[model samples]
Target: MSRPVDRESPDRLYTITSGRSRGGDEVFDAVTLVVAECDPTPGMQSEHSRILRMCQRPMAVVEVSARLGLPVNVVRILLTDLLDAGRITARHPTAVNSAVSPFASPDVLEKVLVALQKL
Candidate 1:
């Protein structure tokens, strides 16, 4: 008898990630953004190639996980491989004026204050 096919089988995931559970030294979260640094090469792993194609433009890690129908952790492992190969780059999202503070900009705070006063 033949074994049933399952896309998310543990064996499949394990094989894809080379039996590793954790990614490289770099930390990758769901909202982290990734971009392809170069085109996919022949004989590259299918998942890696697909990731490269998807990341032609900056794409969030969560979006990639959803699109590929894979768990976030699995995607992170794959991204780490590409990152190590220098085929992709990853970055966490940041606010426009993050250097100043976590609070909203002065203009936005003023608007909110005026609206509250009206109420």
Candidate 2:
């Protein structure tokens, strides 16, 4: 059977995030892998608890954002608090940001830029 949806009040997100636009100084890339550091308490915010549960087996930041239907930055902030509090470990999937295009290498990138300029 499919899992039931967990609906929240329209204002829930604002409350959860405290109206902040940034998560923290810790930069978690979209593909960063995160795992919960401990079992979340029932008293915690629903979003935090859900994130901890979903992260038990390791999940990417992008996956979490999509699952929770929250923007990437918002999720990052929540995760940053968790991480700073030692509640989770955010590991970058690779040394390079996956969002970067394959042609992003300086040599090829410059060549492409020059060609585009000529066009």
Candidate 3:
């Protein structure tokens, strides 16, 4: 027999977004960059504060999603609220030439690895 399922454990995405899917007028993509621009305001959720802390270093939407353990769409909704409140700004990443490989040099990779290890 299969083990029983725990139905109420996960904090469902819909609950986090207050039952909303779409964020707002602005659009967000996986690579969209976000930066925290202001302090937490009144009437904000704890998740919003967490998002602000994560965005302080200029993170992409997908990175934020992974770091925060939230779905991309749910993160988008939180980001939208921040955008509307003027607490964060979202912008697209710079375009790269199709012919050029995005990989960094070995030396740079080593430096990055060291830096990440320190973190």
Candidate 4:
């Protein structure tokens, strides 16, 4: 069943005309229906791609924002969508280990400092 467009949501359904009849008397056209559900806004694809590139490891929202050079709010919105879609997973260090703070690991801290130096 087809429905009217929703103004608030990014999901959209549409039909495309595939081809025409050879005789061309009463043109026969094939209707291809598509249903896409996601943030279809401009630059969303690039944002998703960037997230996928970095999402292999658990990253904070601020880290993603800094890496992508995008505003924190924009990164939050995209992260929310990606999380809802199961494309990415969000993990908190505290959630994983109560005693281990972000700076508790000397090795990890050193690696992060080295990475920052390259930037």
Candidate 5:
């Protein structure tokens, strides 16, 4: 059986995103990787702190949403806050030339395939 989803109420989401419907100038996609730049400070929002701890290692935006039980759009807005505060850094996926090999090794390609399948 699947675990029950644990999403917060819309009101709580709104409060967390500060009434924003979308992220600021920074653009984020499902596969974009995020990493914490530093530990969250005292008095920081609980969500922000959680994100910091969760992102100590690189994590995709979609994975973050799944783990946090938050809507992707809401997560993007929250990420904007962290980006503005310099608490996190986002790395967008780069395009690979059709003529070039995308992965450096077969093992690397296999690992990426496994990760995508997990999602």
Candidate 6:
């Protein structure tokens, strides 16, 4: 017999389906598995919420740190907590091109390069 899903249980499974556009081809994929509980203390709820928001889109520690305006070390600590709680996950920069490009256009690139040169 199949095990019944426990509504009260924090541990639940989720299926993440995605499609990729590769050379005009549409490739579909699905990942299904049980995720661990994500219960954060009231004091840390906001932080956890922010991390969860970030996780919806793949992000690096530096990107999260910059977006949240938190120090890299602090972000790292928070990420560790989220990882332990199964609220967030990390991926290598190369494994996925999730990094938001600071420069998306030639004009923006030029400005950034100029600013870096001045610094």
Find the candidate with the highest lDDT and give its number.
1
- Candidate 4 yields a Cα-based lDDT of 0.49
Cα lDDT over the full model 5? 0.87
Clashing pairs in 3: none
Q: For residues 4-116, could you state the per-residue lDDT of candidate 4 as single tens digits?
A: 64522323111110121122112111111111233234555666767777656555666666777654554555555565666655544433453567666778789999999
TM-score of 3: 0.67
lDDT of each: 0.89, 0.83, 0.80, 0.49, 0.87, 0.48
- Residue 72 alpha-carbon offset, candidate 4, angstroms: 0.9
What would the TM-scores of all predictions be? 0.77, 0.67, 0.67, 0.42, 0.75, 0.42
Clashing pairs in 4: none
Please provide, for model 5 over 33-76, each residue's C-alpha lDDT reduced to its tens digit, 9 standing for 90 to 100: 99999998999998889999999999999999998889999988
RMSD of 4: 18.7
- RMSD (Å) of each candidate, 1 decimal: 3.7, 7.8, 8.3, 18.7, 8.1, 16.0
Off by over 4 Å in 6: 1-44, 95-119
**Residue 51 displacement (Å), model 1:** 0.2
Off by more than 4 A, model 3? 1-11, 24-26, 97-119
Tens digits of per-residue lDDT for model 1 on 58-102? 999999999888888899999999998899999989857755764
After superposition, the stretches of candidate 1 with alpha carbons farther than 4 Å from their true spots are 1-5, 24-26, 96-119
Arrange candidates by lDDT, highest first: which order?
1, 5, 2, 3, 4, 6
Candidate 2 lDDT over residue span 1-119, tens digit each: 99654444436566778877676546798888999989999788888899999999889999999999887887888998898889998887657654586766788889998999999
Q: Give per-residue lDDT, candidate 3, residue 13.
A: 68
Which residue segments of model 4 deviate by more than 4 Å?
A: 1-44, 95-119
Q: Mark the 10 consecutive residues where model 1 has the least summed lDDT.
A: 95-104
Give the better candidate number (1 or 2) by TM-score.
Answer: 1
